[model samples]
Structure formats: structure tokens, C-alpha cells
Target: MVNDIIADERSPVSASGHAYGEAERREANLIYEYADHLQRHGHRVARQLIQIPGEPRPHRTDLYDTSTNRLIEAKGTLHREAVRLAIGQLFDYRRFLSPEPALGLLLPAKPSADILELCRALGVKIIWQEGGGFTESSGG
Candidate 1:
């Protein structure tokens, strides 16, 4: 699912023929690594695709933990813009997810206090790297 999105978003070279290099690819790899961490900890994870209304091609979610019914949106950074983007995507994708799983945002590290507050206000769980492993907050 993620591969499809990466393929669609590919635009390595612009009109100027300058290569914008590995940022996107690295972000994808980061998400995959996070997914792997979940699986290693005994979570049953899968990449999910949501069929957009009136759209032929579906949108893919970063990770879905079937056992816990968590829908996670992975972001390479937890800055304000990235956090906002992930929140919006998660909310939009939820409408198409059956049974309405718990929403979560997976980040490389903990976000700013404001970002954390926003997720808490929206009732979105936050999973971020801390020390040598990942940490989670209920976003309550």
C-alpha cells in the first residue's frame, strides 16, 4: 500500500532537472521501521487502503494494528505542520475504515507541547520514539 503511494508521489526531478533526493524515500523507510517495531512487539500490523469516495484509486494508511484495532498515521517528523497533516489524514481515512478503529499518530520523536495538546484534544493516540524504544500516550 505504501509503495503505491510512494510511486504516485514520485517526482525526483523537477523542470530544472534537479534531483530532490532521498527525503521522501527516507520517510517511507522510517514508517516501515516503526511498523516493524510494532510487529516485533507482538502487534499484528498491516498497511490499509481506504477507498476514497468517487475516486478510483484508494488511499493507503501507514499502519493498522488489527489486534488492537489501531489506525496509525506515520510521520517522519512531529513538527506542527507534519502533526496537522497526519491528523487530517487520519480523520479523513477514518470515515472509510469499517468498525472505526482507534486513531494514532506515529512519530520519530515526541512533538512539541502544543502539538501534543492538539492530539489530546482530538483524542488521537501518540506513539513516539523515546530513549532506546517507543513510548505512547493516550492523548487524553
Candidate 2:
């Protein structure tokens, strides 16, 4: 089932992980893990590479599910400030990859309700850790 879902060229796990900054790379790994989790549940998952024209370079999305073609931007942090920063980054990514509604997953350290609310208002989906792993409740 997992193998079937990830049978695509854009799947993240299908290719080698990028060599981002230490912290960024760690966060990317977590997103990859979440993608693996979703794949285990029989969902097709892919990762997007976002490149804003005239920008510094391109940034990769946490995960993108082929089943739903849902673009997910993952944010992880122990501090509220860091989480906020991640949210901002995700928003930027969404804008760059406009037209497709993006989902934000808060891992380990969750974002505040205010941030979550903002995401809701902006039509960005939210997912977070509940127990042993993460779960998606909206933006299917």
C-alpha cells in the first residue's frame, strides 16, 4: 500500500534528501517521516519544490499527497517565536505556490491558537501531533 501511494516522480522519499541548513534539514527529515506515516496509511504523498521567480532560490514543501494533491508545509520549533517564524515561511511558500491550498503541520512544538486561527482564515489547512504521530483532520 505504501509503495503504491508513493509511486511518482515528485515523491520526496523517492529522491535523496536535500542538503539544507542544519535546522532546516532536521525539519525536512521530520516532514519526510510524516510523509512516510501517511504513506503507511495508504495515501499517495509527494513533496513540492517551490521556486519563486526572481527570488533567491527555490524552497521545497514538506510534503504533497498525490491522492489529494494537498500541499503541506511543515513547521517545527520548541519556542513560540520559532514557530511563528515557520508560519511566516510557510505562508510565503504558499503564496509562491499559489492556487493550491496549502496545509501547515505543527510538529513537536505546536503553534498557538492565534496562528492556527490565522491559518484557518487564510484557508490553510492545519495538522498537528496528537499522540504517537500526526493526523490530518481538515483540508482533505
Best by TM-score: 1
* Model 2 ranges with Cα > 4 A deviation: 1-26, 96-99, 137-140
Candidates' lDDT values, in order?
A: 0.77, 0.61
Candidate 1: tens digits of C-alpha lDDT, residues 1-140? 33433334336775678875454455676667766777788877777878887998788787788889989887776568878899999999988888988999988788888888889999899988788778888563
The reply for model 1, stretches above 4 Å from the true place, is 1-23
The per-prediction tally of clashing pairs is 0, 1
RMSD of each: 3.5, 6.2
C-alpha lDDT of candidate 1 relative to the true structure: 0.77
Please tell me which predicted candidate would have the highest lDDT against the true structure.
Answer: 1
Error of 2 at 109 (Å): 4.5
Tens-digit lDDT track of model 2 for 48-71? 678788879566666777776567
Q: Ten residues in a row with the worst lDDT in model 1?
A: 1-10
